[model samples]
Target: MPETGYMAAAVAVCTAITWALRALPFAVLSRLRQSPLAAYLDTAMPAGIMVILAAYTLRGADWGAASSAGPTALALAVTVGVHLWLRNAVVSILAGTAACIALTALAP
Candidate 1:
C-alpha cells in the first residue's frame, strides 16, 4: 500500500491532470474563436457524445446470448420509446425503470 503522503500527492496530481484535460479544449477554442477547427469541433462534439453514450449503453450486452440484462437493454429501449412518444425524459426514465423492475420481478 502507498504511504498516506504519497497517496495524497498522487491524487492531487491526478486531479490536476483531469482538470487540465477537461478545460484545455474550451481554453484553446476561446483563444481561437474564428478558427475552422473550433467551428467543426463545436458541431461534432454532440455526435461524439452520442457515440460514447451508445457504446456505454451496450458495453455489457451479451450479443451471443438470446437474452440478457447485463447491459440494461430493455430499460434503454423503453426509455427511448417513452421519450419519442411523450417527449419527456423524466417521465420516460421513471416509467422505464418501473417497467424494468416489474418485468424482472415477473421473469421466470
Candidate 2:
C-alpha cells in the first residue's frame, strides 16, 4: 500500500485538477457571453441545428423506394405542420414520431 502522505497528496492533486476542469467552462463561457460571435451564435444556432438535423435524418432515406420513403416523408410533413400549428418543438417532435411509428406499422 502507498504511504498515507503520498496518497493524500495524490488525492489533493486530483481534486484540484477536477475542480479546475469543472470551473474552466464557466470561466470560458462568461467571457464568451460578451463576444459578438456568441451573440450571433445565440441568434443563429437553433435554425442551423435544425437544418443539420433535418439533413442528417433524410440523408440515408431510400428515395427511390416509395414504400420505405413514404412514411418518412409523411412524418416530416406532420412534424412541420404540427410545429407550424402549435409552435412547440417538443409537441411537434412527439407527434411526428408517433405518426412515423403508426404509419410504418400500417405500411404493407
Candidate 3:
C-alpha cells in the first residue's frame, strides 16, 4: 500500500489539476466572447446541433407506424414545442428525450 503522505500529495495534485482544467474554459471563454467567430457560433451552433439531433433521431423511425404515442415523431414534436415554449435548449432536449423514452416504454 502507498504511504498516506504519498496518497495525500497525489490527491492534492489531482484536485488542483481538475480545478485548473475546469477554470481554464471560463478564462478562455471570456476572450472568446469578444470574437466575431464566437458570436457567429453562438447564433449558429445550437440550431445546427438541433437539426443534427432531429435528423439522427428521426432517421430510423418508421413514419408509417401511426399511433398516439409514436415515439420519434412525438419526441420531435415535444422537442420543438418545448424549445418554442421555453427557448431553452438544454431543457428542451432533456424533455424531448424523456418524452421519447416514456412514450416508447409505455407503448403497446
Which prediction has the highest lDDT against the true structure?
A: 2
Any runs in candidate 1 off by more than 4 Å, and if so which? 1-15, 60-67
Residues 43-102 of candidate 3 have per-residue lDDT tens digits of 989989978986764654546444343776788799899999999999999999899888
Order the numbered candidates by TM-score, best leading: 1, 2, 3
Which pairs clash (backbone N, Cα, C closer than 3 Å) in model 1?
none
Q: What is the lDDT of residue 59 in candidate 1?
A: 60
79, model 3: CA deviation in Å? 0.5
TM-score of candidate 1 relative to the true fold? 0.60
Q: Over the stretch 31-85, how does candidate 2's per-residue lDDT look in tens digits?
A: 8898999999999899999889887767755554343678888999999999999
Note the residue pairs that clash in candidate 2. Answer: none
Assess each prediction's global lDDT (C-alpha) against the native. Answer: 0.77, 0.88, 0.84
> Candidate 2 local accuracy as lDDT?
0.88
Give model 3's TM-score versus the native structure.
0.44
Better of 2 and 3 by lDDT: 2
Name the regions of candidate 2 deviating beyond 4 angstroms. Answer: 1-24, 57-67
Q: Whose lDDT is higher: candidate 1's or candidate 2's? A: 2
**TM-score quality measure for candidate 2:** 0.56
Measured by TM-score, the strongest candidate is 1
- lDDT for model 3 comes to 0.84
Q: Report the lDDT tens digits of candidate 1 across residue range 1-108.
A: 889999999999999999998988786668777889878887989989987987765664445433357326677788789999999979998988787677666666
